[model samples]
Target: MSAVRAIEPISRGEFSKMLRRARPPPGWGKSIAVANSGGPDSTCLLYLLHEYFSSDGTPPGNQRNDSTSNSHQKANPRIVSLTVDHGLQSSSADMAARTARFAESLGVEHSTTKIPWGEGVFPPLPAPGAPFEETARRARYRTLFDEMTRLQANALAAGHHLDDQVETGLMRLRLGSSMLGASGMRYCRRWGMGNVIGGLDWAGVEGMRRWIVRPFLGVSKDRILATCEANRLEYVVDKTNFQPEVTLRNAVRHVVKYGKESAQNFPPKLLQDIETIDTALENLPNFDGNLNSGPERLRAFVQEMGREVEAIEKEVDEITHKGRLPSPIGTFLISKEALEGIKDKPLVQRALVLRILRYVSPNPWGSLRAQAKRRSARLEELARCLTTPMSALSKPFSMSSQVLWKPVLKRPKIVKGKSKGKVPAGWIASRQPPDLQNAWGVADRDITEPLLQALEARESEGDGGALDILFDCRFRIRIHLDAIPQAVIDALAAGITNLSIRCDKELYYPSVVLRTPKNELVLNPADNPTPKFPEGIAFAKPVDWVSIEFIRTLGNI
Candidate 1:
């Protein structure tokens, strides 16, 4: 690769263009918060945002553009600076104070939050060979998000430049990340209630999705430093960047900066390729020929597969009235006719099997690449078994520890003055298999014992009000004393063993299951009384349950 020319300091016009590219659509509110660490990159970002958004000022490149002055005035966004003092270093407080002072000079509102290390609020340190940096990052974001909520900010901007993107992409590539992960950071994304370290946390209140905009993502770090120099901005330098032994990121940075043959130094073509892959992924089922010509056939294949999946889902819905069964918790029933119809379509059959597995799996959002490979292997095995005739479907088979499928004979239905006919044997998929344990979240860590113990402890503590708990990252369980009858509560207190809870109606993905010591309660009423809550304690109206709020609380636990 030829030597690249040095990038010039970013002008206000250039910054504005970058902002346009990174800005999310309207309704995110005009309030913006900057993640300032008093470092050069973030400090430069704060300065630029101030210059552009300050009501009484004109930015460097906009001073002579008098025709657009009024428009610029109307476009001013409310800016605030948020500083997180991790307190990892002795000088961390000083750095935060400096950041506040700089924000004050720019006339932006500032707030500082210190992670409580001594209070046992933060999570435990990473294990050996684990990413300590990532653990710290999650803590930092959690703190920042708390402040952002107090400020009622809609968008949080970070100074992650082109170099940071390249570093992250290389790191993910090295770690065998999915294609989407290797594509690197997006310019703008909605921070949902997912992992915090991987840039998947909300800005304001939990469950209220917020925007995280990286306007400098297309600009280089050198250009940001140059911008700071050109404007005479004062910023603190983090010495930790030079300590390669402390974190993998610093090691990658060193290699990118000084190593002659380091793969960390992203070539232009490689960067372009990553972007192309990202674009293709984002525009799924829709591909243009102008981009990578090699993926056209692959793209066509996926599109066809998607269509097949949809058709299978529609047929299943029609046969089973939306892919669900009448009885037995966590069961999905498919008519024998529907299965026979798709038997000839091998791809469709595999797709149907995968869908059933996904529906029952507690962690639906498991690693995409791993899940795909597992599904392919399982599908092949299932296809071979399925070819042995309908009789083979009678035996129960495990998809995973948490999921199982079997064929059952359906009794004939009676019509007026006649027998309609015996319904053919159908397939049943369920998560309630005898050997299955309650799996939590995407990691699918077994939390059955811990959860049962927690509930028992809470009950013993005589906590009378509603207690919400997140179970297996799949559902939120709200145990409300007020919602239950006194008789059932007394029974629960009396130590009823083999208790079960069932919902009256099915909750969608990330479903909330209502449970008690004696009866399993669902959101909807069930035809039978065994699994559902007793009629006396049944809720007359649906409760507005917020899953994200439960997850936010779960983070602390």
Candidate 2:
């Protein structure tokens, strides 16, 4: 048996390197929030971030040779420590309080938000040792992002480390996930976008430009604990993690830490024995290159798969760029020629369909409606329909709360004075009319006030500022921040009620009405050709539209 390699405390330089590798967006570090749970991982991360960003006296032997080494020398980033209490246990609040004290000691502002676990708000609290990890996680992040909106942060930093990544990968593998899922967590991603766990209610945070970053994803758990000890940092331990039966992730973590064949039944006897002796042996430390050998291989595999997925995603982006165009009135124009060009590439077709469906869906990606649309067979069928001729798909199809109507054939319109006819516009994707029953009980969705409030916040800052918000997860509502019209303000201020009506089947949102305080009908932007400032608001450039409660509630009626 080989001797075990010593796990050394993570050096300051190493920490800085990990953060750089995360590739945070331009405005990320200026104002950041940390999702601290009072655990060792988060506690250590908080201390490291405070030290890394602060201009205080630098610890000896922490100098870096990189050009950006001097960047942190006198840096003072706004670091807010945020903690979410799931309220699953009685001590959850106390744990959050302790985290606040720790953050205060480091001179960092702290905020703790509690999740109200009850009927309609969240699923009923799980029974003892029952499967509630995913629910708790989703609700925790949901609350975190809500607080972030209130604080107006540019980024969120999490404490997910390499060990956590490995556990995630293993759990996904056990669940028979694809390479993309088994690749585990990303270092940085846009908040409330993609098929991420906490992407629920994305419209609320759309255009916020907020990112969730994991700087510790490359660091190991052993090294993290060592760093805490070296820095004399204190953190609480959650006993729930030790019970492998509670969750698949916890079970995988046990197998990774202690070999699966441990006398204590490390993975628990009742759980399926998914890990083989070969994989378990690889995790054991009694081998040459003990610390780096097996885990490094797994990390390399994940990284390689991540690179492949990134390339595929880039390709999808390129394909969509040529194929998809947003119409002036909230609908998307799909070029028939572009779809035919990629008809042979089934993978790209499915991906493209997924992207478009996600964009046009009235509900967020994490919602039940959106989840139902994620079926592989449905995507494949949609891809086929999209590539087929306009006459083939005569009937409109509905999925993900959006309707894909019959394609508009390319034809030359009446020309006058040497002017060219209307160009070849293909299929139109619009929001699905509300059923107001079954899963979705709410019929009317009015977000005029919240939308106005968001615009007002941006308007107060300065001129030359523009804000784009997603309305009903379907329409991209762009407003000139500097030129918020008084009429628009009056509409919201007077408690205006807005709703979309199917005035014309051929037109995208033919008529959208806004009722004023005196029950007056405001003109629909889609119907108006030469609208004034308030109605002219739709003329601005488009931006991302994903949201939470307010926008989630703003469904098509």
Candidate 3:
């Protein structure tokens, strides 16, 4: 690791400027939620946001004629402090209380959400190299988003500073990330646009659009500490950060703090490159227009794209509707004309390919990037084949091992009593044959592969019913109680009795069934039992599937 150039301390004015740049439009509403963890960075962020959004800082246009009124009495955008208690440490509850007090001192509303780890509401720590931090972070943000929704806040803010950004970049580099990942964190991103560091699986949750704002991305950690000291703010330090062996982030932090200096200053260029890429993506062939084109032109462009995209969507839908591809999983077929049409338009080709790949991939975004890098040569070959004349492409070809194309002559249709002339031959895209396994091996290069394997192992061993599987860090599967072995249930009952468990009354469980070792049973209140065992527990699968929730949240994006 190379030492990063020290960043200058941030002043309140500079902070305000950063906020102005990242602030959402007025239409998103003025309510903001601050994720306060009672740590230095977050504590400072809470103070700064409170001051910035207070009545004293209200715009002149909204001021009243009454000069004698108290500044606090004036109306301003509502600011709320949200603290999530992960219950990982003994001092977590105390920290939550302290954070609430601090928010009250600043006249900000505060709330705390507790994650019951022992109650099986939260997933267990992941296996090595499976992004444990990313999973925890997603769960934390999920809690925050729920709170924001309940509070009717349009935006949520966090305290991620320059040092954090540097660490993130280094981690992404180590992970063999694409240019997007190497570019590091953005000052502003959509509420759930999962980036390289943060796995995209959990980001597409509903009601998460353009709701997260990080105003301190440009400020250094030292500067944040200095601001806290200048204001005499109290903050709790997490001791885990000092233990470099515990996590990669801590190791990176130590290196950045003490490593020898290097001439390269990568962050500025990285950010610029990311901005340029974003501009290019926004101005794709279907979205060609100047930035200065007013909102009306932008709206018109969006509508036009919407119509065009829908046509493509309908075409894909029709392929499935025709019963040519019956199964939802595995290989599917597309018309040769459709493939040629996509080949003629570069952007459409990329979009259509990405869409098809995403349909079968567990980690769609990661898979897309990996396929692009690993199969670049094959992709180019396929593109050339598609553009060539049909007579020249008579031989079977493949886009990649995963996407195979074979030419087959289409039978000519008879018009009345005579044959209508030969119809152009179409192509079929399907999975490569088993003998060609080397051509398209299963995409096992993903970080989530090991985790998926572990889940499958558990399922095979019949332990899956007792434990919920966190699939791809995106979905959770809770098997029905009946599927669990009796011995497992007996053991669980014994443990619960030993622990003297006290369940939260307000906590909702979709399905709960308990049986004692003595053949006694205690079922959830909602259960409807059978006659054989009058007190036996009945099970009904819940309608709220985790995968469905993910799809609903991210929508069509």
Candidate 4:
């Protein structure tokens, strides 16, 4: 290790220097887990933090008389340098070992977790390719998170940088991500990973004990590389990163860098423009109410975006049909349809889409172009060279064609809501008869429209999600349906006996299941589906609460 030097010096304003000075805010737990893969960014972080803390005892910024001439303020966490070995690489185990040694060299407490390492391993885990990358990343997190909890490490850290962020934003942009995806990574967020053992929600959740941290996001790739260079550190650059066909991040890592550099030319001006966009977003009065509406404005946005999303999907389908992967952006943008499909749970859906898209590589058959094409000609020549036997120990070679298998969506048209309707053509399960589909979105209008509108108004003000009540109708309303669970049927029938229908309108949508009086034995229509409980039964829909006297005969109890 040697003295540090800047790889790419920031022009002060271009970088978010505030992050350099920013400490974890109050209430955020403190012990840090730096995912020190021996990558330059992480190594830099380790070196800075180790030095930062060490120097603090001697003096503030000013050096004591015995301090070396060029020494800088050491920046360190109460650092635990952790490495995740996905074991997809032949050198992965060694990489972990080497990283551990390197972390020790930096005078930091280091640990390593070997993930997905087992017998029958080949060039990549599960015998190499795109699936291997996902296997590696997920395993890496699982191990890291597990370690975080086992060690009770309070904050989980990573070495993601500006270049990575820029690449991610570009990837999201290409994918036609909705507003949140376009928002880029937040500085911090609660980890979605949580656990409950035996249905008790306490400190028992596995990963919930540790908060994920990314201190380096506000920094640049150059700073990390500079730190690595200054420390004389060696990082193994996985050959797959340069292979475009393997991951969108690799492709955009190349493509997005240009934009980052171009922004450098007029850094101040571009930043000013970015700030202007922020100002506009900030000025918009209620985010969900105004711009993100259901009528003309939002409907138009959805309509226009609807075209783009459809076009992108068509492009992806055509490419796959032709036995190829779309460009990184193409794959990402095409995923918006999948995201839009789960509109109610937007964040969950976006995360799912992002996780799946990151595994695709642009190059389909990267290494074996000539061999697979000229197989007929090689047959005769190979007959003479039969003395040579092939071995799995063939110097870590991978043909990459194995990773090119296009993803097959076995179950399409995943309508997640209790029900949905008016979806785009080709979006839902086509097998579901069209007439049934037509009635899918048809709201039951007569259950009391004026009253329901009032309920909707109350909900608009952030009331509880829905209200359910069951009472007898004076108007002989013959509500017929069979999908309604027996318990609900009994409740509703009993309610009808002593009925006083006041707020009947609130019970019209998918949230309510009505049954005709004749089908009192069993009345459940297409409107609802309940989890099958072999014994105790379940609420297929809201529990119908009839007036007092009606309750006596509910469920014929």
Candidate 5:
């Protein structure tokens, strides 16, 4: 591992130094949203800003300047704590409500932006599966960004501290991240509402806004905890954080649990490595060229960049898990290359993956989720039968969103030679009932594709074939951030689609790797011979319903 093995304590002066370096480009305005989960890290940041304004050395109100000697509060930067209730636990809303009250006392105007409670955002949720966490995080962020717009806040702050940084860095490293991701959390990252896609999440110039800020990013959780204790700051304890099996983050936290180390004792080299990685990342190329392109072109570009990005990917992975800055420049190239590569796809998908998968596949989403293990394997074996194996492998070179969900009929009899089973002809994979969904009904299928000759085409939902497929269904639902109610979740359960139910509080998930139904997990397009999901692990259980947790517990898969 690198010198930045774990979260080390930091003195106020040291934190101050880090903050100064992280200062945003002035004009964030007076109205700010502090995304406080009521955790100590966020609580401490809110308090610190309030205290900064309250201090004697601070300049008079409205005197805005970077100087610590001339600190001032203009319009007092309305410090509102936006607590997102992802309704995974009974205590979730309670914690947020309590946080609002505590924030009110701290003089921070707090508002609970319950992210559209259960059955809120779309694409619906699958039953408890490994995909829940990643899906929920995206939902949570989508809500937060929407709230920032609704609240008209110029800036948004979250509670990511040193430990979070370490975790992120480690995750990025573990995930075949480009070096930029493995650099850990930054005090100020561009916004997809504080996402990796920066401003690329939206297409138009109007969408480019650096509205999110992470004030406590440079500080450690220990310092925040200490600050809370010192100032008598009260916060909720997320029990899941202590549980080792819930997520990789929790597992790592258990591995690098912190003790009572004073901020005065942080290692210099750790700081140095942080700086080095940061600097290297800063110097990497910004992908501004893919300004306009179709999905296919972007896919080709991403794969092309993958070869060039390997060196950095290796280093970030090394540093995150092994804890070492294997090669700074190499790491820089990886992130830079990919960012440049992915700019042409749907802004949301590209940004979502960039911000996250630095840790899943780091490949295009459509391509990653498509295909079966045995099919891909068989395809490879078939390739070996070609006139030139390498040239035949070129068929896999293309990626198409159209191909992502293409339901092809399988000619099993044609492939019976490859397998020991007596296969029937015309057996399509899509036609095979998904084992999991066997219990749940499917829903919202296309009523019609298009009536090219008729004006009524615009009024159609979709073709009858797909609609016929999903006659009726329901899903076990979970909300990343709370807003609506259990009733809505119930309605969805009763009305929507195929599902099984289970709820997990910590959906802090890993990047998704494609797992074919036949037991092949592809690490991502970024890696060679795709790695297996550790320990034969294919899917994770994403809690289906938060409401159920109030009454019972759903154990592991």
Candidate 6:
């Protein structure tokens, strides 16, 4: 085969266009943060952002303060640089400090957060392997998110590029990932720690959300290096990246760019270990093809998969919009008509069911690849069951902590002796109620801490602030801080900690309640949905503070 041709370096105009297409949330215009590690990719991104913001008349961080400029005219968002120092290497601190200095030189705000690895926060790092890589990454992102929230930024940017996307797709393919899973990283997405709960208004939230934008996903790594070189910028190189034994990603990088002979560069014992891993992976049933084939072919394959994923997502949105019923307090409803429409196409049906299950699941679907596959198979079965006639419907079943009930059809009127055919409504699905005898199958989640955290964030943003909190991982409750009664605010501030949401046993819907440390009730919606309390603690007039909704699809929130 002929050698691959070298690509041209990215021009400044092209980089600008890519940034425009990155599509950071509109709220990010007020303040945005970047994850800068003092590497070539990040360093170039920092410089370009500074340049991009500066090119538009006024520089970033210079919000107009004169009387002539109104609040809306302060369009240049403040740029913040965040560095997570893992301290895995001796030079980690120094690298972070250098990055801070570089950012400050460009008038960008900077902060460094040190991960307390092995210090009770995160467990001691395991020996160099795939597990170590995953652990380290989790620690790094957790720190970054904490800092971003405290700083009140809107979004965090990462330096992931097209090469990283190709590597991720290849790795997923080797591990037997689903087609949608193998599409690799998204250009803009919610934080992975939180599962994909879609459909939230982007404007009203306080502080930085769990969003990470990747403008460079379509830009090649070589272009990043070229950008840094052409502008005469210096960056640090992490030497450990060259050592393949440290992580699977490093090993894959070697195999993709170099050949199998790259393993010979390691010591005799290490070389043997690399070959063993390669053999094991190749023996897997779903290992698609040889990674030794150049990166170009792998890049093309991921692009095609990405197109297919987009097409599937579009179909999902269409069916969901046309036939979805407005979700009640704790249940998800899909019209029987919708299911009947897609009855013959099992692929679309399976995709729709998987999305609904993920949205209503009480537990987050973290890196559980095997369990996800099993659940996918079960979801496919449920999808097929939707096509069964109402007369043949089976008993209610449970999956992912939610109960899929038999279809609820509108009954015929009894005015006439002869009955009319049944009216089609929809299938109702709900969370499994907690059962004392069946401890293993019980479903319960206490969202007190998350609620408290959100309230604190709202307090920091002052009055009239709005934010959405996920209750029991099922309901999206949008809280308007200004509309909350002063009594509830005082109760929270006075050290009452037990805030909870419970479903009515008979009605099977949700209600809000607050209690003291000993579980003594402070406030209960059941006492009166709108009651007057002592100290003139009446429910705010026309209370529109809290609005609840349910997710219908898998997209960015």
User: Clashes in model 6: which pairs?
Assistant: none
Judge candidate 5 against the unseen true structure and give its global Cα lDDT, from 0 to 1. 0.41
Residues 254-316 of candidate 6: C-alpha lDDT, one tens digit per residue: 776886777677756556545654554455344455556567765676677767777877788
| lDDT tens readout by residue for model 5, 1-557 | 66764443444556556555555565556667777777777777777766654454233344436554433434445666777887656798899898889888977666786555444333354354443666567666666666776777777777776557655654454544443335555566445212222221221111234356676654456667877787788887888777645565655454444321211233454333333433433443543222123223323333344333444444333323332112211111112223233234222222222222221121221122222111333333322222121211123222321111111122234454574443211100111122233223222122112111121332264432210110101111122223323443343334432222211111211122222334422221232122222355344332221221111001000
Model 6 worst lDDT run, 10 consecutive residues:
199-208
Shift in Å, residue 217, candidate 3? 1.1
Cα lDDT over the full model 1: 0.57
Please give me the total number of clashing residue pairs in predicted model 5. 32
Among these predictions, the greatest lDDT belongs to: 6
> Scored by CA lDDT, what does every candidate get?
0.57, 0.62, 0.53, 0.41, 0.41, 0.64
Identify the superior model by lDDT, candidate 2 or candidate 5: 2
Pairwise TM-score winner, candidates 3 and 6: 6
lDDT of 5 at 455: 18
Put down candidate 2 lDDT per residue, 1-557, tens digits, no spaces. 99989889887778767777665556455578899999999999899888877855344566654576566655556889999988889899899999999999999999988786764445677788676777788778777877877887777889998888876766665544445455678888666433422344342435335678898887788889999999899899999888776666666566555545432454444345445323432453422322123566655655666676666567777766776765645456777777777878776676566666655565654343543344656666777777775553356776544555446645555567463534445677766665443232323345466656666676576444545544444444444544545665665666554422212233323223355444434344432432222232233222122211222211110
Q: Which of 2 and 3 is ahead in lDDT?
A: 2
- Point out the higher-scoring one by lDDT: 2 or 4: 2
TM-score of each: 0.54, 0.68, 0.47, 0.41, 0.43, 0.74
Q: What is the descending TM-score order?
A: 6, 2, 1, 3, 5, 4
In candidate 3, what are the lDDT values of residues 263-371, reduced to their tens digit?
A: 1233454334433433543445444543333334433543344345556556545543442433222334445566665555643444444444433323323344424
Return the lDDT, model 6, position 539: 31
* Model 5 stretches astray by more than 4 angstroms: 1-16, 54-76, 117-120, 123-131, 193-207, 258-557
